[model samples]
Target chain A: MEEGTASKRAAGRFCSICTQRKPALRRPKTLEQICRECFYAVFEEEIHNVIIKNHLFKAGERIAVGASGGKDSTVLAYVLSELNRRHGYGLDLFLLSVDEGITGYRDDSLETVKRNEIQYGLPLKIVSYMDLYGWTMDEIVKVIGLKNNCTFCGVFRRQALDRGAAFLKADKLVTGHNADDIAETVLLNILRGDIARLSRCAYIMTGEDGPIPRCKPFKYTYEKEIDKYAYFKKLDYFSTECIYSPNAYRGFAREFIKDLERIRPQAILDIIRSGENFRISTTTRMPEQGICERCGYISSQKLCKACVLLEGLNRGLPKLGISRIKAGNDGSGRPDEEPTRRGREVERPILESKPCGTLDF
Target chain B: MHLTLEFGGGLDLLCQSVKIHQVDVAPKDENAKLTMRDLLAWVRSSLIKERPEMFMKGDTVRPGVLVLVNDCDWELCGGIDMELEEKDVVVFISTLHGG
Candidate 1:
């Protein structure tokens, strides 16, 4: 519903949460006019409630927050650290980032992540595509051009985060994915008719069966709320769109979700609920679980997406991994295989939503 | 009316990367109270140096763009129709930017 701020129009109105101070925000999720103090309280409290309800963490758990130094991740890092300290969750938090090696874009954003490393007092680790896949996005774009480059970056980043988290020996990975992002993914998966991801895109936690289990503390939280939180709290975050993949297929879904949010803010949550409840028919064959024989990363196919995409780049055949469908097993795994080595922090970029066009794996 | 306008969440990039603007916004017609609608038009014509579409859709902001008046939500202050006062602080933040 379009928020009825006019009905309650007045800066003098007390906050709905505290009923003391002047309200500063109309919470998109609940349409509550809350003051700054109450906004911080409920925002953290709600996330705490979500964490407790979902049982997302344990006392001694080492959690790696997938930090891109963007508004969502930056705010997520700040709030997660705040909650952990305030609630005595006893979680060891670390910041993990993937460098896609986009020259101008990632270099600057990575600087933000570094500052966050100190500001939040969390240890930080970054893995780069140059190290992991032997190709920067700029290098890949030169050969592959802009068409479907997101596929390569998206595929590689999924593996990179897992690898980075694994390197940190973290029990679970947390990302800044919020309710709005989940809603957009639900719509994108449906539009693509990719039933596999559509079934689990709304999940609060994913990858439980694999290398690194990832959770979104903001899953039920609104994106606008996150923005307000970041803005009001004065969190330092990078906001430039990724240099590559400026107008992506996902952008359409994002814009559509935003439009829907303006018309009906509850539609964002409703969309997530719809995504969470979709039941795949028994007859539909889901992709079986498999590890990439190449890099040992988790994959449904014989070779994981990163492996296929990397091979495509290395072998001078960029389209080899460009499939919107399951990347095929058309070619043999590379004869030369090495352990998941330490990728040098060569370069990278991301921001706005889907920084570096990070799609759901 | 004298107003303090702030741009953030990448909106500042449209206006020569300046985050805050202090400008005198005179009522277009004698003594008519200045609403956000008028101020937006003024900002678009006079301040926003690029990508006006990112800031305005029709007479209001792009749907995801938030307007706050004097640190209070513009939505809570009647949104686009909200009237301004002397030295009022209006903040525009685009929540559409990814984190």
Candidate 2:
């Protein structure tokens, strides 16, 4: 509708969206050549539309954005705040980050999140693995080594976010899970035969039954778009692979989805659609959700994944709960091991469950 | 020809962590113009100090990397065949990094 931003005269082609400024970048989803100004308009507008269409937010409601200081979350926090003011959404916005306590990886990214708090003029709340779990990721990795350390980081981070949100008393939590991330999760769930997750991976809104409902406003947004948006805006963001789990299982699925996007960008959304359409059989037995006896968090077994992993670390048998196989009889694995610490604690066996995937937040 | 190269979105990690490089790269033949395909090879050998696969696959940049020639998507100017000129500012940003 209007011309803005630095001009990019690519082959003298004009923006397909606005027809005023010269085209700057070719969009992956529609392959339309758009100017930077139009890109901003559409990019911001599409996210706003998603928020409206999905009823993700309401006026006067406080929403906490899960910030990792990475490109996706950085751009997400910036854009969400911008839209909140520009559209008069009247929502209370803040940044919530989890410190995994990794030496170099998390320490550096947390600096960016702190910068974002000042730059975006939003309040920031950070909960650390040390404070919440009483052990930092560095300490956990030291005890368990790098093999299944992600399982610990992933599970701890998930709870850290929830606890952080609860501390802020925010009504809902939003993460920057883009279309590419959701698609990759869909593929991974299908490959792992995780019917429970496969049924809900593509949902724009999830965890409504929990204490704090979660929303993915960027559920339809592309990662490349996030990268480019951050680039054009010169938004400060951190980008470094986590040193501990560089080859996390989700990395392969991510690469495969990116390759598929290159061949056909719509493949990403199509895969999400497939995930949404998947129907679970009525006869299939699903794990019953129950309160974790130890931590009081939601768990399918007697204890939550966090309690199980933490107890493992405390017992010095860090691999106790990592086995994916369901030990048929409860309390069978390491029956005689009493939790060295936590005098009142009675250790319980955890059922077979998949740890959260590593999608780099 | 003299040109400015900038790496971002964690691409600098592959190149000794130096973000900007100003260099003179000669075309394989003085009579022919230099293309992105040539510059890519030059950067891979001369600039990228670490994992080259993270920046390239086969001849072109891997699927998630975005290349901009003078702030324009390289695809607009003929992709890998885009001709390079003096003092051109080419940016290579890898979108595959953590976020």
Candidate 3:
């Protein structure tokens, strides 16, 4: 104890783990009386191995991270930046956040992402639904109604990210979707009988010619572990649900998977591994994919869906615009061919007013 | 039984409800004709007929239209290359912005 105290006179910094100014204080987390330097080395070693094992960071690649200011993305940016710097992965890291202009939720999260940009020393870009369509998510919800808010956000944001990535010329885009998200998506696909999605959703999505390669470095990491890691590391992240994302279906799927995880901790991993092992039948007469006639985005036959919807909004036919709800099968036991049930007529004038955007197929 | 039908959401009134072969599922898989191709065809033809000006450039769907086959996105599956199976539900939602 006397020798330890003597050492305190020589060193001037505090221990980060213990948060003690006493130089002699031993940081139990680091398992040594080490300072921040030693702490970072030990912490980064584990992350380094994870990256290498997964081949996440490629040499001389411009990496664009889809940062939502959430725990998953923030941690992703932190770890990737650290690894890039410490291990010399030679990655030019940039942070990209697609702001769907969702009231309260996304606005607050974007503020956190701004802070993270400065803290992590990564360049950031924010694309908003308002900028692209001249209408906010809240505004769209009122016009299109809450029934399809998820559709607008998800679709618009997806195109926004892809377009943003292309503008930045990023070779890769890294999303923060972890194991829990992957597992939930798998079940959602199965329930919906989406064999195509079920077959292609892998943890490591390679960059295709037209579409940017999207990678999930934390693919193997669980949501709980990400939460714990963020807590332990004192990471600042936005923790809120998207205001318009009352996606009961996804929530149900998430709960179903979580319940299974209670019995088998590796359920998430198993689902992901299963996704890897599964093969899709490619012999079907697949829909023809073509560049969007307007934005030049890859679509099934020219004119990507985003451009079509954006054109609708631009033409002031907001009501006539398609929504995300229309993207999911409600399983309400009613077929699309069924007549509009009682009181469903209220949704018509809105669709009819838009001369250019009405669905007349 | 072949029935003339129209779809809801963005896939509203079909053009004359063209006659097509219908497959019956045991009350469970009857609504399985939805696919990215169907939605794209609907959007392309509808946009052409309704918004002829929008289609002045050509007969193609503009970007931001979301066609989901069961909660899974059509874009993810070969981007409209996805096949529709029997009893599969299709949802053609527009990704419009208006608050």
Best by lDDT: 2
Give DockQ for candidates 1 onward, in order: 0.57, 0.56, 0.01
Q: Candidate 1 chain A: worst 10 consecutive residues by lDDT?
A: A349-358
Q: Which of the two, 2 or 3, has more lDDT?
A: 2
Per-residue lDDT of model 2, residues A1-361, tens digit only: 0121123225557889788877878898899998888999999999999999989998999999999999999998999999999999999998999999999989999999999999999999999877666677887777778889988888888888888888899999999999999999999998998888886878888778888888899999999889889999999999888889776898899899989998899999999999989998999998777777655667787767776776667656677679864322232333244433334333342222222211223
- Chain A superposition TM-score per model: 0.88, 0.88, 0.74
Kindly provide the TM-score of model 3 when superposed on the true structure, using C-alpha atoms.
Answer: 0.60
Clashing pairs in 2: none
Candidate 3 C-alpha lDDT tens digits along A1-361: 4344233333444454555533222322222444434444544575578678877667999999999988888888998898888789999999999888777878888999999999999999987766555557776676566776676666677767776787788998888877778877777878887765675665466445555767777677666445444544668877555667654467677666656664566777888888778776668665655555444456663445555565444444443336432322111122233222222222222221211110100
Which regions of candidate 2 are displaced past 4 Å?
Answer: A1-9, A324-361
Candidate 1: segments with Cα more than 4 A from true spot: A1-12, A323-361
Query: B1-99, model 1: which lDDT tens digit per residue?
Result: 778999998899899999999999888897698888999999999999998988888988988887888677788877888887777888999876667
- State residue A249's C-alpha deviation in candidate 3, in Å: 2.1
DockQ-based class of model 2 = medium
State the TM-score for model 1.
0.90
